[model samples]
Target: MVHNCVFSFKLSSAREGIRSEKVRELIPDMLSSYTVNIAYHANNPDVGMALEKDAGRYKLFNSDVGLFITLAFKDKKYTENIIYNKLLSDKLDVNLGYVYENVVAQMLIAKGNNLFYYTMESKTSNHLYEIDFLTSVKDKICPLEVKSGNYRTHKSLDVFCNKFSNRICNKYVVHTKAYKWENGIYYIPVYMIPFL
Candidate 1:
């Protein structure tokens, strides 16, 4: 049998100032479909070591504070090149580079089988926004925006949502917090990822 799996991590103590009841409730159910593995980074070196060692095999989720699920999968050739180029560019700082690397790495792990990261020419601008990742789930193409902060306002996500709203059921804003839905877009906290 083919088993679809997810590994989750908690990154926050509360959501919007209240204790996260949804996070508490959803975590156990999220674990039910996959082989569950849990760890707290505060006390566990093993979890960090494991994540770093096989970073390609897990999907990362963040509660609110830190890195969550570490996704497992294979890397595509073109995406690897984009990541490499970004790393060499003086524009991205170390923290930003880490965020991009981790996001791309997690994406490779979660949707490696179906997605490709590419750059597409925008009709309005000669410059390109590195088309980060693409995957077809249930025959619909899903585009993802990888960002580090909890804030969800993103121009790329908005563009993708508007352009493909009919064809795409959902667009993801993967970040370092818990999931929420606003204006039909799914704001997925990195900790609660691969569930949708």
Candidate 2:
């Protein structure tokens, strides 16, 4: 199921160990399922500018936003239908970052952009700088960070753009906030993702 894939992906990407073989196998199977359903395909961005030989580093998305919305609540028979209406009306108390991330991924996919993200590995510590999404425009990469709230500390996006300034076109923080320009990062509303 897509929920399991999302959980597994989040765990692995967060550097948490997945001990179950069944859980490991479900990830690829979910990828294939999404592809077969014409929803989305896997995207693997290289750790650096140059392409890496390994395809292990990747992200999966739902190409259809509607399908993704439905997939999010597939587990609960009673609550599944309720979430859709509540989420649309901004009534849900639960954290909506995963939903927003999925929609952003869907929008990027619809725009014909491959879903890619950047993360810097730390040698001495577990700390890492992670950009939520990356897109190429005019020969430069644009880094985006998705947030569910107005809390505006974007250290990852800042560090990434700073280190890769010459290779970056723009920096963005997508959230529920209205449009604003601050310290070079554009804070845009979630609905405006397609226009970006």
Candidate 3:
């Protein structure tokens, strides 16, 4: 299920060498205490919204991040010594984007927010631009993108804001940096998510 959370259906299949249907079947208790699947916002005109579960875009995440950390180290026979030290010292050699995303999902869930994200292919290029999470702030939708680093090329956030300017209340790029407003987008630290 973590594979499904990190990679798309096709990419996960290629990486894990399993059929996509099998991935869907593994997490039977979806959106419950065991797991949660964040569905794409289908109402967007370019999204080609589909009612069918298998036809829609989604990202899976563990309901509790504490359990998730333990599950992540399952292959090591419960030996989380290396993982603990690395995380504490901030030197883990793995991609932390998924970890951040999972934590954000857990936080949002704790705050009683249903998870949803948006992704679209660029018209000029084949590159896909994605908003990590879309949350309703008051009456307007807030588009958020999570970044592990300080880089600032958030094409998806930009595109989504431009396309749905009136619908958006505040655009955010969640990262490790201090809170600041650049142009109209708010660069918020990960710890500040709960307040937002």
Candidate 4:
């Protein structure tokens, strides 16, 4: 339950050399066994099995974050993993957006919530604006953006809310901050997400 503290990861393919297609085939079984959880990227504000979602573009999170952390350090000896060393000194200088997203998935799932997200390519740039999580409430959508550390902006959430204000009921920026509500958005502390 280390909710905060900074960490980052660079994308890397699986070390076992399993083809991604084969991995995809095994995912249904994994999901059924609670080995993994999936957050779909939806095209609209629908929930449950009725969502118009992209099966091809989704985020996968391990069902257990502690196990995921342990598996991330698969060294023969504990002293050899560079990440473990950095983590010990509290000097990790990485962006761990995925980690926070994984924990949020766990909390949401534990509270019987299904996960969804939204992403759109920027009109002016080649980059994409991504809302980290999206939930439907009373037929309107709620967009959540997760930020770690002393960050002060929610660019993706802003863009999403601006475009879909009519379809949105609430906007949330979840981070390591005190709970507050301002400007039509709720600033929720990360620890309180389970009760949300």
For lDDT, the strongest prediction is: 4
Task: Tell me each candidate's RMSD, in Å, in order.
Answer: 18.4, 5.5, 4.0, 5.6
lDDT of each: 0.44, 0.65, 0.71, 0.72
How well does candidate 4 score on lDDT at residue 16?
A: 50
lDDT of 4 by residue, 173-193 (tens): 888669999988999977888
The positional error of residue 21 in candidate 2, measured at the CA in angstroms, is 12
The better-scoring model by lDDT among 1 and 2 is: 2
Better of 2 and 3 by lDDT: 3
For every model shown, the clashing-pair count is: 19, 1, 0, 2
- Candidate 4: where is the Cα deviation over 4 Å? 1-21, 46-49, 73-76, 79-92
| TM agreement with the true structure for every prediction | 0.44, 0.72, 0.79, 0.79
Higher TM-score: candidate 1 or 4?
4
What lDDT is reached at residue 113 by model 4?
80
Off by over 4 Å in 2: 1-50, 80-82, 122-124
Runs of candidate 1 exceeding 4 Å displacement? 1-94, 97-104, 107-112
TM for candidate 1 is 0.44
Residue 11's C-alpha lDDT in candidate 1?
31
Candidate 2 residue 107 C-alpha distance from true site, Å: 0.7
